[model samples]
Target: MFAEIITIGDEILIGQIIDTNSAFIAQELNKIGVSVYQISSVQDDRAHILKALREAESRSDIVIVTGGLGPTKDDITKHTLCEYFGDTLVENHEVLLHVEEIFKKYISSPISELNRQQAWVLSRAEVLHNEYGTAPGMWIQRNGKVVVSLPGVPFEMKHLITTKVVPRIIEGFKRPFIVHKTMITYGMGESAIAEILEPVEVRLPSEVKLAYLPSLGSVRLRLTGKGPDKDQLNALVQSEANKIKALLGNLIYGEDGGEPIEELVANLLIQKNMTLGTAESFTGGRIAQKITSIPGASAYFKGSVVSYATQTKIEVLKVPQALIEQYSVVSAQVAEAMASNLRALLKTDFAIATTGNAGPTKGDADVEVGTVYIAIASPKRVIVEKYLMGSQRDRVVQKSVNKAFELLQKEILKL
Candidate 1:
């Protein structure tokens, strides 16, 4: 089955509030084997809402509407739904009780007539109780079609839909089994990854769909399977995913929505009973921040020193002053020195250090912009890698940080 989600809000259209409702609804619908065909956003106007509702009903088996069901005046979804379903406003004692109870929990005042009227929506819809807020969710079934209207507040909508609406839809509809798998990849651009997997993409069955979702430093490769039998569908997708994995190999870091690179590195270190420290210059303390964002990182993460200046690199990380003078701060020699010095200073099992000119302007006139050096200090040796990234300061910094973590991840794997 298919559904269309219509979010009615001027805030969404004007970009004041993000339309997170659509993504939540789509994922829920997909989980129950229902596909979301289209999503639309309209302002709080009766004519526009009615038009969108009509179009949605014609195209989809179900139309899920949210927003504009507030007690306040710009909320017109309830009234429009009433007109569409050929019903007049009627006072619901149960909904009024819910609304009044919600108010009493917050304030010590009695409910007003306006609050009572807010609970009284068209009786045609199956009044779905809103446990989180004053507004009630509505469900209407007519002419072999279903339309569900929910409150715009995310928590309230979540409670009503998960507890009531989704169960009803699952019972009412018969849908094919759907299976999906995702592969996460890094160190390759989207176009390059796509080109590498083009042959695999072309040979997939008609029931299978492949989607590429590219992000800041990685691409999520999603493979969706739709068939009558759930097991058969899953097996088919898994087989194809294995083929993609074989082609991509270790370049495919983790799979199916893995943790961020920093978290992955931290977990690996913890698993191996290793401790890590960092000495960062161009990246500031961003490397440490990313690593510490994961819980339980304190156990494996020794510490980090933001040696942004040459003096700090020498004094804090204890990078040799002679190395800095000879090769400059943005050189591989300084990066290796920083890693080795921090490794000894912090007394950690492993250390990662970054030294680079992350810049719109060059750190040294002759060094050029975006010249990055990453060093991973292992027990045996310190491995250093050089990169000349783009000219943009932020992009250069981000890519350099990601690459440094990736290199550290490789070093951990070796141990």
Candidate 2:
């Protein structure tokens, strides 16, 4: 089954708040074998909301509206839903009791009239109790399609969907089984990878499909299969995945959804019982930040030195001043020295370093914009490589960081 998601808020349109609810709801729906048809963000204006709802119902079997369910005046989703359903707003005693208890126990204040109005819901709707908030979720059935109204608060919306919406969907409709498998590959652009996988794609079955999700320096290949038989569908997708893996080989780093590059590196370090350190020039401490973002990193991560300036590289990472004079701070020689010194100073078995000229105007070096050098210091040797990332400053820094990890991963595997 397919569903459409509408996020009703002026805040989302004005960029005051991000519309994360659509993503969360879509993922949840996908898990239950329901696909999202379209997602829209409309202002809190009544005409816009009504138009969006009408359009959504025309295209999808289920329409989920989030936000605009608050008790305040700008919150009109509840009233709009009632008008659409040709129903009236009525006080629900059970909802009122829950709201009162929440206030008395948690909020510790007398409920205002505005807060009490949260108990008034669509007369034709089935109330979805909100254990965490004042606004109750509404479920209405019209002409065999489902319309659900939920609070915009992420935590409360998540609770209502998990506890109420999903169960009702399963109980009411028959859904096909959907299976997804993702594999990560680095060092190759999407066009290059696609050229190799074109033959494999041509052979994929009708029910199974391949999608490429690309990022800075990597691409994630996801195989999604849908059918009545879960095991058969899973096996079909896995069989196709094996074909892709056979063609890609070691180019594929990790698989499934949790396979972030940093997490993969962290796991490998833990497996080998090795410690890591980083020295940074253009990337700042971002490499260390990505590594430490994973839990249990303290066990394998030694430390980092953000040698962002020529003096800092000389003073902190102990890169020789004479070398900076010979080859600028953004050179491969400086990057290699930074890595090698960081490995010895931090007493880590592995070290990664980044030095680059990411520039609108060159700060220290006269090199062109996007010139980057990434270095890795292993137990046996130190290696550095250069690349021209792009003209964009942020892109250059991020691509440098990704390339650093790629170089580090290759070195780790050598050990």
Question: TM-score of the candidate numbered 1?
Answer: 0.94
Writing each residue's lDDT as its tens digit, candidate 2 over 1-415 gives 8999999999999999988899999999999899899999998887888899999999999999999988789998888877777799999999999988988889967789999999999998999999889999999998889999999999999999999999999999899889999998989999999999999999999999999999888899999999999999999999999999999998898886576788878888999999999998889899999998887889999999888888989888888999998998889899899999999999999999999988888889989989999999999899999999989999888888888888888899998
**TM-score winner:** 2
For all candidates in order, the CA lDDT equals 0.87, 0.91
Lowest-sum lDDT 10-residue window in model 2: 256-265
* Clashes found in each candidate (C-alpha, N, C closer than 3 A): 0, 0
Query: How well does candidate 2 match the true structure, expressed as C-alpha RMSD?
Result: 1.6
Candidate 2 Cα lDDT to native: 0.91
